[model samples]
Target chain A: MKQLTELHAMVSKAVDELTFPAYPTDLYEPISYILSLGGKRLRPALLLMACDLFGGDVEKAIEPALAIEVFHNFTLMHDDIMDKAPLRRGKITVHEKWNANVAILSGDAMMVEANKFMMKVDDAILRRVMDVFNETATGVCEGQQIDMSFEQRNNVLIDEYLDMIRLKTAVLLGGTLKIGAIIGGATSTDAQLLYSFGVNLGIAFQLQDDILDVYGDPEKFGKQVGGDILSNKKTYLLIKALELANGDDANMLDHWLSVEQFNATEKVAAVTGVYDRLDIRNYAEDAMQTYADAAFNALDQIDLSEDRRQYLRQFADNLLVREY
Target chain B: MKQLTELHAMVSKAVDELTFPAYPTDLYEPISYILSLGGKRLRPALLLMACDLFGGDVEKAIEPALAIEVFHNFTLMHDDIMDKAPLRRGKITVHEKWNANVAILSGDAMMVEANKFMMKVDDAILRRVMDVFNETATGVCEGQQIDMSFEQRNNVLIDEYLDMIRLKTAVLLGGTLKIGAIIGGATSTDAQLLYSFGVNLGIAFQLQDDILDVYGDPEKFGKQVGGDILSNKKTYLLIKALELANGDDANMLDHWLSVEQFNATEKVAAVTGVYDRLDIRNYAEDAMQTYADAAFNALDQIDLSEDRRQYLRQFADNLLVREY
Candidate 1:
C-alpha cells in the first residue's frame, strides 16, 4: 500500500498544477488563491488511500480526489463569508481578500468545477460516483445551514449536534473514501464498509477536536485553547455542559454565554472550570471512543489485505491521537 | 410539436411538484419560495421544444428542463444578492426576504439540486449533458463576474459587452437547447446547430431588451423605460454611444454618468435624447438583427422537418418583435 505521505504529495502536486482561465480575473483568481492556500489535503489523500486499499490505480483517482478537495475548499470559501471570518489557514479569506460577491461567485464556479472533476471516472461508474458526490455535497450545505441556525438557538440537543457534524464534516470524509473504493474496484459491500470506517473516524476526530480545543497545549493544537468557548460556538462540550451543569455552574455558564463583553481569559477559565466540575471531558471522550471503536469495527469487515487494513487503522489512530 | 403554452404549463407543473426536505426550513424554504415566484419559464420551455423538434419524448426531457429553470433561478437568487436587488418579479427577492447568508447558502444548494435534476437523463447521455451544463453554468458565473467588473471600469468595449451578455444570458439558452437536442437523440452536428440557434437568438433577444429599455412604451415594456440609462448599466447602446458620440454629446453623456444625484426622469429623458441624436437604437437594432439572422441561418441548417423549422422561426420572430 502507498504511504499516506505519498498520496498527500500526489494530491498537492496535482493541486499546484491546476489552472484556470486568465479572463474574469476576480472570479478565477479567488478560486486559485483558495486552492493554493495550503491545508493538509487530508480528504483527497484519504480518497487516494481508500482507492489504494482496493488496489485501484491511484493515478486515475487523482482528479476525483481533487474534486473532493475543491469541494471542501468551496465550503470553506462560502463559510468564511457567512462566518465573517477574516482569515483561513492563517491567511486573509477570499471574501475578505476580494469581496463577498467575488467569493460567492467563485465558490459557485468551484462547485461546478468540482462536479466536472468528479465526472472524470469511467462511464460505467459515473452515475454512482455522481450520486454519492451530489448527496455528499448537499449534506455539507445542509450541515452548514444547520450550524448557522444553531447560533440563534439555545436549545440544541446532543443528537442534533452529532448529526450536524456528521452531515457537515464526517459525510465528506466518508463519501470521498467510498468514491475512491469504488474507483479501486471494490465491491459495493466493501465500499460501504470503508465509508462507515471513514465516517465514524471522522466523528471521533471532531469529538477529539472539541476536547483538544479547551484541554490541549496551545502550541500543539495550533489555536487558542478555548476559542470555541470564547465564541460560545455551541460545540459538543458546550452543549453537554449546558445539559449537565446545575445551580452555580449553570448560572456561571449562562452568564458567560449571555454577557455582551468580558475578559477573554477569565471566561475561558470559568467555562473550563464548569466543564471540569461536570466531568464533561470524560463524557466527551467516552463518546469519542464509541465512534472510534465503531470505525475500527467497520474497518475490520472490509475486504482487503491484512496489512492494508492495518495501515488504515494506523492512519485513523494517528488522526485521533494528534499532538493533543 | 406541442404548443408553446403547453410546454410552458408542463414546466410550471414540474416546478410546482418539486419538493424539498422539511428539516432544514431555512435552507429549503427559500429555494421553494424562489421557484414559486415564477418567471416566464422561457428557457425550460425552449428546451422541451428543442427536444420535441428532434422527435424526443417531452416526458423524458421534463426533469432536464426543470434543471435549466432551477439553474436560472439559482443565478437570480445569488445575483440579487450581488446587485442588492430588493425585488424579483415584483416580489421580495430571496436575499431581501430572508437574508444574504440564507440566499447564498440556498442558492448553493439550488445549484446542486440543478445538477441533480440535470443528472436525471438517460445514462448514455449523462456525461455529455453534464459537460454542457457545467460549461454553461461556469459561463454564467464568468459572465456575472465580467458584468460586475464592468461597473468599475469606463473602457468596456462593445465586443466585451457582447461577450458578457453571451456568457451571462445566451449560453444557458444555447446549452439548454443543445442538451434537449442530445436527449432527443439528435446527431452531434444537429445538436451543435440547435445550440448555435439558441445562442444567437439569445444574444438577439438581449440586444432587443437593451433597445426596448430605451425606446419601448413603458406600458408595453413592463419596466420603466430607460432603466439601464438611469442605472448607468453598460449595455450595448451605452458602449456604442460612448464610442460613436462626438464633442457635446459625449460631454453630456459623461456628465450624466458621473453624477451621483439627479432626477431619474430627467436623466432618462436626457439619455434618451442623446440616444435619439446618435441613432443608437438603430445601431442596436442592426446588431440585434445580425444575431437574429445568424440564429435563423443555424435553424435552417439543422436537419429537421420543414414544419418544425417554421415553428422555431415563428417563435424567434415572436420573441424578437415583442410588444415594443
Candidate 2:
C-alpha cells in the first residue's frame, strides 16, 4: 500500500512537469487544469506497476504511463461534453468552466499530446506502444458512441451493455497493462495475461461504480446518490432490474423511466424500492465478484511468484472496496 | 498537370474503397458520407506526388496519403461544429445531418482511424512519419484556437492572422510532403525543403481563398461571394484594410463590422468597396505571390532536374489559378 502511494506520487510529479505555453491559454489551460484536478492516478500506476512487476525499469515507463493518464483525461473531457456533464470528480468540467468549443479543441490537443508522450519511448518499442494505444483509443471512442446510442434506446440487452462498458472502460485499462508489459520486455504470453487481468479488473471496477451510484453514502460517494436513476442512464443494475421485474414492479420501473418530470427524492426512493425488491444489489455484487475472480484467474497465468502477484490482488481489492 | 490529375483520381479511388461497419451507423455513416463528399484531394495528392517525385513507390504511400486526408477531414468536421457551419461541399454537415454529438464523436473516430492508417506504413519510417504528423496535428489545433480567439477580438493583426493560418492550414500540408519525402528515402534536408514548399504554398492557397471570397466572380467561386464579410471573418484583406484605412473609410468598415444585422449583399459590397479603395485586393494578391515565390524557391533547394521541378511549378500554378 505504501509502495502504491509512492508510485502515485511519482505519477503526479511526472504529470506536473508537463507544461504548455501561456499564450493560447484557453486551449492549454483546461488541459493543465484537468491534469491538476487529480484522479487516483490508477491507470498510470497500473502501467508502472505492470512494468515493474515484469522486471522492467520503472523509470523508463513513466512517460508512457503519463501518456495513458492524459489520454484517459482527454476522453473524460470530451465525454463530459457529450454527456452534458457539468462536473467531474466534484469540480466543474472543462466544458462548463470554459465552453464546449474550448473543451473540444483542448481535448483534441491533449490527444495529440498523449501521442507525443507515447512516442517518447525507444524506437524499438514505439510502434508496439502506438499500436496498443491506437487500438485502445479507438475502442474508447466506439464505446462512448455506443453508450450514447444506448441512452436513446430502451431495449439495451445485458450483453450489449456489458460489451459497451468493456469497450468504454475496460479495454484501455487492459491496454495500459499490456503497454507496460510490452515495455517491460515481458513475453507475449505474459503480456496477454496481464491484459486479461486488466480487462476483468476494469469490468469489476465499473460494475462496482454502478452499485455505488445507487447504494453509496452521499458524503463518501462525492456525487448525488441515484443520479443515474434521475438521468435514465441504462446501467447494468437498471437493465437487470428491468429484465427481472414483473407486473406492478415492471409498470413502476417503466413509469420512472418514462417520466419527464418528478420529485427527485420521490423518484429515487421509489426506484430504490424496486431495486430492493428485485435484490439487484446482490446480483450486482455477485456479477462484480465473478469478474474480479476472473481477473484473479488471469493473474494465475502470469509467471510471477505468489508474493509479487499479491500486490495486484491487494490493489484490486482496494479498488473494489472504495466507497467512491 | 496530367500526372497530377492521375494522382488525384488514384486518391479518390483510394478514398472510396475505404469502408466501415454498418452497425453504429450513426457513428460511422458520417465518416463514409464525408469521405464520399470529396473535396480537392489536394493534400493526399501532394503526398503521393512527393513520394513519386522522390523515386518512391506511390503504392506504398497511399495509406499515409489517405491518413493525411482523413486527419484533414476530421479537423473539418470538428471545426464545422465550432463554426456552426451548416453546409460543407454543398451538403449538410455531419453536425446538421446527424447532430453535434454525432459529429464530435465521428470526428474523434476519424482521427483515430487516421492514425490507424498512418501506422500501416513500413516500420522503418513509422516513427519519423508519426513525429511529423503529431507536430502538424498539434499545430493545427493551436491554429484553430488562435483563429477562434481572433473572432472574439477586433484588432487581429495581419502577422498574427498569418501565423494562425500557417498553424491552422499550412503545417498539415507541409507535414504531408515531409512524410512522403521521408518514406521515399529523401535526406532530412530535402524533406525539410519540401515541407517549406508545402507551407508557403498552403499560405498562398489560403490567401487566394480570401481574395476569391471578395473579388472573384460568384459563378466560379462556388461559394458566397462575400461569405467572410457576411460572417465578420478576419481575413487578410480585412486586416490589411484595417491597417491601412483612414478616417471615413475606417469608420465605414467599423460600422459594417459592428452592425447586428443588415442586408448581406449591401454589407459585402460596402466591405469590398473599402477593400477596393485601399487596394486590399492588390495587397492580398501581392502577398499571395510572395508566398508562392517562396514556395518555388524551396523547390529550388531540391536537386530535381528542371523537368521534374516544372511539374511542381505547374501544379502550384493550377492551384493558384483556381477560381474557387
Candidate 3:
C-alpha cells in the first residue's frame, strides 16, 4: 500500500515534468495536451517499482519510465488517427482536436522526444535499455498489425487473439518491467523472470477487460458495456459462444449477427442469454484466473523480497477483482 | 573513387542484411518491403566516406552508417503516408502498397530498428551517437512542422526558409558524418568540424535541388521541370520573385498565383520569364556557392592529410554538381 503511494507520487511527478517547450505558435502544444489529458500511468509506475524492487536507484529510472509513457501516448495518437477514433479516456483524441496532420506530425515528434528522453538515461544501462525498448516498441506495432488483420477474419481462435493482445498490450509491461529490473542491477535471469511476470499479468489484465466489456453493469463501466457486441467485434466470450452455442441458441446468435443494422441493448441481452446457456462467463473467468495465477507464479520465481512482491501482487489483485 | 566503391559495396551488403523475423506476417513485412525498394544509397555512402577520410574502420561503422539511410527512409515512408504521396523514387510507397495502417505501423517499427542498428556501435561512442541521433530526429520533425506551416503562410523570408531546411534536411547529414568521424576515432573537435562540413554541404545540396527543380533539362532532370512554379509552391526562386518582381511582372506573378486553372506548360514558361527578369537563378546559384564554400572551408580546417581530404571534398562536389 505504501509502495503504491510511492508509485502514485512518482508517476504524478513524472507526468507533471512532461511539458512542451513553447514553439513559435501553438504548433507543438498538442504534445502537452495529450499527456495532460491523463490516463492511468500504470506502465511507467510498474517500471519504476520494478527498478526499486530490484535495488536500482529509482531516480535514475525515472527518465526511461517517462520515455515508456511518451512512447505509449505517441502510439495512441497515431493509432487514433488510423482508427478514426473520436475520443480517448472520455476526452478528445489528439487528431480530433487538431486535425489528423497535426496528430501524425505531433505523434512523430513525441516518439522522437521519447527516444531523446531515453538517451538521457546514464550510459551504464543505455544500451540494454535501448535494446529492450526497441523490442517492445516493435512488438507493439506487430500487435497492432495483428489486430487490424483480425478485423477481416471471422474465426479468430483463442490462441491467435491471445498472441495479438500479448504483442499489442502485454509485452510493453514486460519490457518496461525488465528494463527497470535490468537497470536496477538484477541479473539476466531475474530480469527475465520479471518480464515473464509482467507479460502474464498483461494477458490476464486484457482478459479481464474483455469480460468487463460484456458482463459488467453499464452505469459502473464508465464506457460502453456490450459495445463490442453491438459492433460484432470479436472478444473472448463471443468467440466462445460461437464455438459452444447449441442448435437453436446458435440460430438466435446467427440471426442477430446477420442483421444489417446494430441495436446495442437488444444485442447485449441476446448475447448475455447465449453466454448464460453455455456458461461461457464461467469459462472466461476460469481462463482469466489461470493467467493471473500464472503471473503470480512468475512473480514468485523472481528473487524480490516478500514485502516488495506483496505490494505488487496486492495491487494486481485489486486490479483483477474489481467489480466494474 | 575507391572510397565510393567501398561504400557502394557496403551499402549493398547492408541492404541485404535487413531481415525481420516473418512469423507475425502483417507486422514486419511492410518494413522489409519498404527498405528493399532501394534508391540511391547516398546518405550511408557519405557516412562511410566521412569515416574512411577520417581513418575509421569502414566495417565497424557499416551498421551505424546504414542506420542514417534507414532512418532517412523511415521518415520518407511516414511522411509519404501523411502526405498521401503515391510513390517514392517511382516505387509504390508502403502506405500506397499496403494501406495506411500497415505503413504507419511498419514505419514505427523501422524507427525502432534504426535505433537498434545505431546502438550496435562500440559502447564508448554509443552515448554520443544516440545523443546526436535523438537531436537530429527531433530537429527533422520540427523542420517538417515548419515546412507544413509555410503552406499556410503568405510571407516566408529566405532566411527562415534556409533555417527550415537546416532542421528539415541538413542536420541529419551532419549527424551521420559526425557519427562516422567519432567511430573512426576522430577527436571530438574533429567530429564537430566534420559536422560543420556536412551541414554546409547539405545546404548547398538542397539549394542545388531547388535549382534543378526550376531549370534543369527535362531528360536529364528525370522529372518535370519548373513544377514548383506551376503550383505556386514556395521555393527559393518563388520567394525571391515575390521580393524582387516589378510592375507588370509582379501583376502576372500574382495572377498566376491566384489562377486555379492554367496550362501547366504555359505556367512554367511564364514563371521562367519572371525568374529571368529577376535573375533569380543566378542569385540562387551564388547562394548555393556561398554555402558550398563554407563547407569546403570547414573541410580545410579539418586536421587530416590534404590528399585524404581531397576525396571527401570531391565526393561532395560530385553531389553538388549532379545532373539527374
Candidate 4:
C-alpha cells in the first residue's frame, strides 16, 4: 500500500484537476473556490487506503474518493450558510463571499456533481456505491437538521448529541470506507468491519475536535482558541459541565449561557475554569480514547494481516495525536 | 398508451404512496408538505407517456416518474425561497410555512430523495437515467442563476431569456422524456427525438403560461390577472412590446419599466394596452404555435404510428389551449 502522504498527494492532485463550466460564474466559481481551500483530504485518503489495504486497485478507487471529497465540501458549504459562519479554512465562506441564495444553489450543483463523479465507476459497482451514498447523504441532512434544532433546544441529551454526530459526520466516513472496500472486492463481512472501524474513528475524531477547540495550543489549532466558548456553543465540554455542576457553579454556568454580552477572553476563561473544576476535559479525553480503542478493535477483526493494517493504524494514531 | 388523464392519475397515486422517514420532522415535514401541494404532474405524465410510447412496461417507469415529480417540487421549493414567494398552489410555500433554513435543508434532502427514487430502476438503466438527471439538474441550477442575474440587469436580450428558460424549465421536461425513453428501451435516435418533442412542448407551455397571465379570465386563471405585468416580469410579450414600440409608445413602456411605485391595476392595464397596441399577444401566440408545430414534427420522426402519437399531440394541444 502507498504511504498516507502518497495517498493524500493523489487526492490533492485529483482535486486540482476537477472543473466546472464557466458560463454561470456565480454557480461554479464558489465550487472552485471552496475546493481550493484545502482540508487534510483525510476522507478520500481513508477510502484509497482502505481499497489498497484490501488489495484493490487504487486507480479504480479515485472516482469514489473524489465523490466523498466533493460531498464533504458540499455539506460544509451548506452548513456554513446555516451556521452563519463567515470564515472557512481562514477564507470567507461561499455564502459570505457571495450570498445565501448563491451558496444554496451552488451547493445544490455540487451535490449533483458529486453524484456524477460517483457514476464514473463501472456499472458493476455503481449500484452498491450509490446505495451507500444515498443513505449517507440523507443521514448528513438529518444530522444537520438535528444540529439546527439543538440550538433552540435546552434539554439535549448526551445520547442525542452522539447520534447527531454519528449521522452527520461518522456515517459518511464509514460510507467512504465501505465504498472503497466494495470497489476493492472485499467480502461483505470484512467491509462491514471496516465500516465499524471508520465510524469509531470518526466519532473519536469529532470528540477530539471538541477537545481541541478549547484545549489545543493556539499556534497549532489554526483557529481562535475558545471560539466555541465565545459563541456559547454547547460542546461536549460545556454540556458535561452543565450536567455536573451544582449550586454556585451551576449559577455561574447559567449566567454565561444566558448573557447576551460578555468579554470574549473572560468568558472563555470562566468556561474553561468550570470545565476544569468538573473534570470535563478528562471525561472528554476518556471518551475519545474509548472510541479510538473501539476503532482499533474493529480493525483487528478484519482478515488482513497485522503488517497490512499497520499503515491504517498509524494514520489513525497520527490523526488522534495531532494538536490541531 | 394510457389516456393522459390515466397517466396523470398514475403520477398522482405514485406521489401519494411516496413516503419519507418520520424523524427529523423539520426536514421531512416540508418535503412531505411540498409534495402534497399538487400541481399539474405534467413532467411525470410526459415521462410515463414516453415510456409507454416505446412499449416499455409502465410499472417499471413509475419510480423514475415520481423522481422527476419530486425533483420538480424541489426546484419549486428553492425557487420560492429565491423569489420570496409566499404561496404555491394557493397554500403557503415551504419557506413561508417553516423558514428559509428549513426550506434550504429540506430542499437539499428532497434532491437526494429524488436521486434515491431514480436509483430504484435496474443498474443498467440507472446510469443512463442518472446521466440525464445530473445534466438536467445542473442545468436547472444554471437556469435559476441566470434568472436571478437577470433581475439585476435591464439588458436581458430575448435570446438570452429563451436560453435561460431552455435551461431552467424546458431541459428538465426534455430530460423526463429522454429518461423514460431510455428506460423503455428506445434507440438513441428515438429518445433524442422525444427529447426534442418535450423541449418544444415545454417552451410552448411556458409561453402559454406567460400569455395566460395577462389575457386569461380571472375566474378561470386562479391567479391575479396581469400579475407578470404588475411585477415587471420581462416575459415574451413585454420584451416584444419593448422591442416593437417606437416614439411615444416606447417612452411609455420605458416609464412603466423604470417606475418604483404605481397602482398595480393601472400598471397591468397600461402594459396590457401596450401589448395590444404592439400586437404582442399574436406574436406570442404565433411563437407558441411555432413550437407546438415543431413538437408535432419531432413526434412525426419517432417510430410510433399516427394512432399511437395522437394522444401526445392532443395532450400538447390541450395544454396550449388552456386559458389559465
Error of 1 at B31 (Å): 0.2
Cα lDDT for residue A180, candidate 2: 91
lDDT of 3 by residue, B82-113 (tens): 67899888888888888887777777778888
Q: DockQ, per-model, please? A: 0.89, 0.78, 0.68, 0.85
Q: Give the TM-score of candidate 2.
A: 0.96
Give the runs in model 2 whose Cα sits over 4 Å from its true position: A217-224, A263-265
In candidate 1, what are the lDDT values of residues B129-150, reduced to their tens digit? 9999999999999999999999
Clashing pairs in 3: none
Worst 10 residues of 2 chain B by lDDT: B1-10
User: Model 4, B205-279: lDDT tens per residue?
Assistant: 888889999998888878889888878888888877877899888988989989998988888888888889889
Which should have the higher DockQ, number 3 or number 4?
4
Q: Kindly report the docking quality category of candidate 3.
A: medium
Model 4 spans > 4 angstroms off: none
Checking candidate 4 for backbone clashes, the offending pairs are: none
For model 1, the stretches where C-alpha displacement exceeds 4 angstroms are none
Residue-by-residue lDDT tens digits, candidate 2, A191-273 = 98999999999999999999999999889878899999998889889999999999999999999998998999999999999
The numbered model that scores best in TM-score is: 1
Q: Per-residue alpha-carbon lDDT of model 2 for B182-254, expressed as tens digits?
A: 8878888999999999999999999999999998888988777999999888999999999999999999998
- Stretches off by above 4 angstroms in model 3 are A24-27
lDDT of 3 by residue, A88-204 (tens): 888999878878778877888889888887777777778888888889988898888888888888788888888988999999999999998887889889899889988888988
Candidate 3, residue B310: the lDDT equals: 85
CA RMSD, predictions in order: 0.9, 1.9, 1.9, 1.8
Better of 2 and 3 by DockQ: 2
Clash totals for all models, in order? Answer: 0, 0, 0, 0
